[model samples]
Target: MDLRLAVYHAAREGKLRLLQKLLGGRSAAERGEATSGAGAGVGPPLLIAARHGHRAVVDYLLEQCGARVGEGGPVSFDGETIEGAPPLWAASAAGHLPVVRTLLEHGACVNQTTRTNSTPLRAACFDGHLDVVRYLVGECGADLEVANRHGHTCLMIACYKGHADIARYLLARGADVGRRSLKGNTALHDCAESGSLEILKLLLDAQARMEKDGYGMTPLLAASVTGHTNIVEYLVEGALQQEEDEEEDEPAAEGKKDPSTAGLSSSSSSGQPQVYCTREAAVEALELLGATFVDKKRDLLGALKHWRRAMALRHQGGHDLAKPEPQQLVLAYDYSREVSSMEELDSLVTDPDEMRMQALLIRERILGPSHPDTSYYIRYRGAVYADSGNFERCINLWKYALEMQQGNLEPLSPMTASSFLSFAELFSYVLQDRSKGTLATQLGFSDLMGVLGKGVREVERALLHRKDPIADSVQFTKALAIILHLVFLLEKVECSPEQEHLKRQTIYRLLKCNPRGKNGFTPLHMAVDKETTTVGRYPVGKFPSLHVVNLLLECGADPDSRDYDNNTPLHVAARNNCPLVMSALMEAGAHMDATNAFKQTAYELLDEKFLPKAMMQPFNYVTLQCLAARALDRHKIPYKGFIPEELEAFIELH
Candidate 1:
């Protein structure tokens, strides 16, 4: 009854004969008319036929039924207009050779460009359909040289993707051997990039020019860099033959530069004699492909040290800045292999703690005491100790590592300072200002606050001496943590009137130096939120206490500064279900309508889950003010919008 459903079923069922009979009887002019879907009449029928690979039905519809193809059309199912693709493209992509042939035979443009500017041939090539490629190229005479929207020719794509059969077919059909893309990439460049020897040989036999790409890299040179030996060898042999042939042609031109040889040599920017311009001449590529070499231990170690130095210099600039010479890559490869053997030792020890200890022993044996490597193992051992909950031993081992790191100039670099910050923070928070009998404590690391304070002073002095910004940040953060811990310790020391006064002084000093400090919490933020932090050994006393909040605000701390989520310090106080702290904030002019990142205002966020109904009495004044402001500011729909429904009750309360 519905022509759209009948057409849809006929296309999907591949009822070609039925489709031809029903649609063919109509006049060509009327048959071309698109039948809209019965429901919303949004999409047409031909797109559904094409998209589902009902090519026989597609051919009948387009050639006989006269269905519209490409650009602006529709699907009956979802009303999605077909975007720039013809039925032949669908046929070619689905590898329906018979349907493709039929459609092409009926003046369906074979080289038709779709929305993406992809031709039928490009679609067939991308799908790796050999029969379809042959049909599009041989039968339909589709242009193989036509570039896609990306300017990639069919042959270049096939070659680059390692579709050897398609590549050979394009080559045999006289595809442009020397054709270059918009980025100056030849067909051979694609083969080199893919590292496919079969595709490389096919292009080479087609006499693809041996030329440099956009990066001044010849196809063979690029292949070599990626370590493709077979491609390298074949090109090398071809190049040698070409060289001999050229020399024979120019026997009498004494001292006259041969054009081919001159072009090859002058192609590179470095001006190195490009003798090994052939694919086979990539010795580094060949060696990387599978070459092995023996090295004397002395030479190996020396090379390792030298390459490491060069690698460090490269780090300071970039990998390209300190471009390793050919010898350097070769030597570094071997030296890197020696270093890799150390990783094997890592696998032999199953337990990480034991392995870390063994790694330390290896570092001590190989690098000697007082070396950077030795100090690294000592710090690693400290980490293992810390992770195992031996906080005392962690403190001991880290102190030893710090002492050794300080003694060695290389060990005491900014890198070491960065590493110590993590250990320092863990010690302050976890170890509870407890002095472990270590070299650091023996050298008067009696008070953690004193040692941390000295670290701050040293970092400041060192900052002046070296102008190291990275070192300054790391050291300053570590020092600020110590002061926070100092404030924390004062809060814990038996709460008295004197202790309260002392706590105020300590927090104010922290706020002065590190205003918007570590962990996104100022000392004031920490003081207010200390109830949430679960570090047991050292806490800023039992939290949610009114005095801690009162003293903090009294010491000139801003109660309005928000956390990352835009929750003001008062919002944190409320969400913690602390009515006393809430009362203090409300008394101190804390805004109640302040919304967090979630768009939930402090009044809206108050829940029975966290805050009971009894908690509402304390929050009544601030909530009422917020509601009254919203009610007073309400306007018409065109002007603004109606007030949020949740605010109505609070507005009534106000």
Candidate 2:
């Protein structure tokens, strides 16, 4: 190994002699790089030693080598680096109690934080380091409520990670239980979501109140969504008992009612208002949980059981419980409805597929399409179909999800980009010859052409309102390559005049928008370049095709359009060794002797093997008009104001 890396290894392995030897006679830049932990993926020597519990190396570096005690560096734990973490935090998080004690003894601050403001106390609580936690909080005067930048306290982390003993210690140390994070999630919500029933009881015993998150999700609903049956059952029982207690404690005074129960109950035959209404919220939670079991867990029987319980609770005790209605009809679900009676819920057992569809419908209705889980389960169900060789059904569902993403998500969103990439990969798969035995349906012109048209529309929509994005963005380049491949696929299919016209019309729209990607490569430029073939994981399309090039030229693509390197389409074709495409561009009025930024012509850029087999020669390209333009430019003759604009532009092209 190199001496710089050897120093880090010695420090990490606690080899004080090797580290002492490597520490002497280093260059200024190398020493600076080591001390700052800013070298190529290596932390400081003291940080590495402290993280691995090398107390001798730590003491030597700090005392003998004068290493900075509070110097922050990148330290890793469990395969993820926490940038700007002090040595004390790293040692505490790793449970190296000896290193932790040494660092603190050397005057390392107990409340020092990472880049995200996660304190050392919070770090110790995260991994259940009880001794480190005790030292940091009990002896060193660490603040119990010093949360991270997201407002997550030490108590919250302990509860979420199921460290019940650590949580008890924090509770006794005056850690706040009701403090919420930036997303409005408390300790109760975290324990509920993680299914830590022991921690859940601890927080409940501490009187942690039930509250909704930023997405309006209660702790009960969060438990149901994660499919924690034990926690959900326990919380549901508690909710019922609490409702009973509140009802019994209600006063019997005339014309006076509890504030939460006023105007809540529906009228009965007795004309006396019933105030026991906690079952309404419980029924909704169970119904939503049933949807989770169906889509997230793939448990049809379990989903039916939860929905049956929800329906039973909805009707029992004469409460006014009802499932919410959809604001608009969903064509993807075939206009599904919630089953009103227990018989309807039981009838779902006969047809498992219908029950699956109902799960999707209920999730979308409750979560709404804007929420990520709504589209997630939709695409997930589609993928399941693709895995079972039912690709036609898969394509239909994926198309619905794709359109839904386009409508709801912002332009150029990753989810939308992923949907487009999925279509490209799917089209490439079913068109392969090996898929012929399993796929019953044929890949059609309409299927490929339809997505291509939508893809173009999505690009147009992005450009309609905002300024055009930089073409070098990764997302933009991926989109451009995918669009070019889609056009390449359209060439293999046989289309009538109108279909072909529509195809040309779609290409026309894209060309009119004049979008570029990755070093200003236009559609025509990408069609003739070889690098576009590596845009996807699988083989989507080969570039430099004569057919794709000719179609782009016929549909308003500029023949001599230049990229960012000042290389025109002919220049790109020459680099790719596409003789046919170069000839087509030359025939379409491309300048044969035009120079790029490298001052090399298309004929000069061609490889030597192709030079002997070249279709167009130097003698054929040389003309008196081109010679006159070059001579004028070489001798500095100025004729710009004297000539017409088009003639002057042509002279400059040389």
Candidate 3:
């Protein structure tokens, strides 16, 4: 390693003696010259030492070498890199109190923030470092109201993290309680959603109003959505008590309250219904809480309990809260209906299967299919079914989720790519399972073909707007490899004449899209390369696969198509030592004498160990025309104007 990087590493590891040994009493200018230029990769020496809580090393660098205290450099937290984080911000975020104190004592800016505008105090509050928070705020003059780019404040993070003492300190310091984030969520809403009942109480006592967020959710509903039963009950009970106190204090000049409005109050002054107020909010909270119990907790009995309470509340007044109805019955949900009456809801407990179906329906209805949790729970349920040996149900539910993601997410979205990759892994695992005749069902052609068609559609969508770059190459390549794996798996299925035609039509559509992966590899290059297996968590599919290669050629993949390296698929086949694939490509009219950029023909590129196998081919597939093209190119004969444009281009391939 470079001496500069070596010194930087020693400083980061907190070895003060080693750092001193390396510097050897050099002058400040010499030391600075030794550890210059952002420490190469690990930020400056002082930044890394402070980030890792190396107070001794930090002092040595600051007092001895005069390392800049306020200098900003790259720092990473929780696998995500936060660029340009100062020493104080790194020390504070890492919860190193002494290191933070040392940096602060050395004249570090207290209000210094990261590239994201997250402050030292905010970072300290995030991890519940009360001492660092106190030092920064009470002594160093750290600004409490300095929010990050997303407008999230220190009080909001403190409350959400359930740090009661820190939250109290911030409140005592007059951190604004009603401050809303970019998403319109206040500290009380965050506290409720994170299940911090104590913080919720603190915010409520601070007069935090019941307000709607960007999602139109109040604190009570936020509690319900996150399955915090204690917070829900508290918010509901408080709202009810406040409503009674208001009724007692109101003037009689307003006239007697209508007898019909029992559980709910009249509309507010804005003419908008005050549904977020009084019992109306409580009713909605219970309904959403029931859905949370069903999907998130997977507790059917608990869901039933919440639903019963909501139904009881609904029936207490002349006006019943309307439950939103699905416009059309979904076959995926087994056409389950939302139970409006208590009798219908009560009957669900007798049949567990029906109860589970009701849970899926209720969650989808309440949260909508667009929410990530809705689809995540769906996939989770399918995986549970797969573990219990119910493979058919698992496949059906996964198919539904893939369809939903395609409809909702952007084309070439990572979520959709993940779904496609999951299908590839599942199909590969099932096919390789020896007990398929007894333990698992037979693989079907449509099952693999359907996902391939969707994968092709994603590619086509990305291609439709040519002005925009294709989805980043990683996503594009993974999708391409998965589609090839699906094609490989389809051959394992016994298809009828009609099924075969449908399969070919899908393959044709994919070929016409002409999508390219990394290295500008066409489908043919990917089919012959061995790296295709590492696309997923599992070893998804084998490559240098003759079956997939044949399928590509049969579907009109060009045999002589050149990649970015100008190596045809036959060259890739040769590098993999795949004689059978090379023979097949040669049979499909691939030129054997076509030299790549390295000027090596496929036959010359063959591995020495594979020579015994290469000798078994019927004959060398190189032709007189190919040799003549190669000779003209090698000798630099000027044949461009004399030959046809197509033939002239062909000669350049050598």
TM-score: which candidate is best? 3
Return the candidate ranking by TM-score, descending: 3, 2, 1
TM-score of each: 0.44, 0.83, 0.86
* Model number with the top lDDT: 3
Residue 607 error, candidate 1, Å: 8.9
Q: CA lDDT of 401 in candidate 3?
A: 85
Off by over 4 Å in 3: 27-29, 37-41, 70-84, 105-117, 141-151, 171-189, 204-219, 238-280, 432-436, 465-471, 595-604, 610-619, 637-643
lDDT of 2 at 449: 93
**What digit string (tens of lDDT, one per residue) describes model 3 on residues 235-285?**
666445544444576644546454223335322446332322466667667
lDDT of 1 at 518: 38
Off by over 4 Å in 1: 1-10, 13-48, 51-53, 63-66, 71-85, 105-107, 138-141, 172-174, 182-184, 194-198, 225-227, 238-281, 287-629, 635-654
Task: Write one digit per residue (lDDT tens) for candidate 1, span 296-411.
Answer: 12122232332333223222211122222222221101122112232443353353333333334333433345545456546665666667666656666665566555555442
Span of 10 residues, lowest total lDDT, candidate 3: 258-267
lDDT of 2 by residue, 1-654 (tens): 766577788888889887767766666555545555555467778888888889998987776666778888888888888998888888888899989888998999999999999988999999999999999998998988888988899999998898999999999888898999998999988888889888887887787777878767778777877788877777676445544444576554655333223323322235332222246556666877898899888888889999988787666544446667667765555556767889998999998877887888777666667766778788888888788887777777778888888888887778888888888888877676444575734668898998998899888877665464664356667787888888987776778999999999999999999887777888898889998888667888888878888888999899878887778899999888887888888878778787777777788888877555356665565688888877877788998999899878777777
Model 1: residue 108 alpha-carbon error in angstroms: 3.6
Residue pair clashes in candidate 2: none
lDDT, model 2 = 0.79
